[model samples]
Target: MTVTTRLAAAALLLLSLAGCEGMSRGQQRALSGGAIGAAGGAALGALTGGSALTGALLGGAGGAAIGAITR
Candidate 1:
């Protein structure tokens, strides 16, 4: 990927992580999990030539569900 793409992804990840300031523990966990999963999925999708958006959506949903179920 180009430098610009990498930078954009980094910015997006940072922005996602910055939104958990006033949330409950479970809400924070779910948001954190979803952000991490989406970043991972987007990176994998970029490397594998798949749809990053689809991967992000799927990963975010799965992560949120798991986070919600864990405690």
Candidate 2:
């Protein structure tokens, strides 16, 4: 995988770890979704030769929305 994808995945994994520490359900969902989305977007972007930052932003937004709605 590319640098952007790697970075994003690392970030997502780290955030996921927070959920194990007794964080609020909403907070955990939001964080998890945002992280996953960012990583997914970055991976997709890297494959398509797109901008990592843009992918991250869009992913974060989408994730946030999904997370909020889920809770």
Each candidate structure's TM-score, on Cα atoms with residue i matched to residue i, is: 0.66, 0.65
List clashing residue pairs in candidate 2. none
The TM-score between candidate 2 and the true structure equals 0.65
RMSD of each: 4.8, 6.4
The best candidate in terms of TM-score: 1
**Local error of candidate 2 at residue 47 (angstroms):** 0.9
* Per-residue lDDT of candidate 1, residues 18-63 (tens digit): 7777798898888778878888888888789999998888888888
Predict model 2's lDDT versus the native. Answer: 0.84
Q: Per-residue lDDT for 41-62 in model 2, tens only?
A: 8877778899988888888879
Q: Which stretches of candidate 1 lie over 4 Å from their true place?
A: 1-19
Q: What is the lDDT of residue 34 in candidate 1?
A: 82
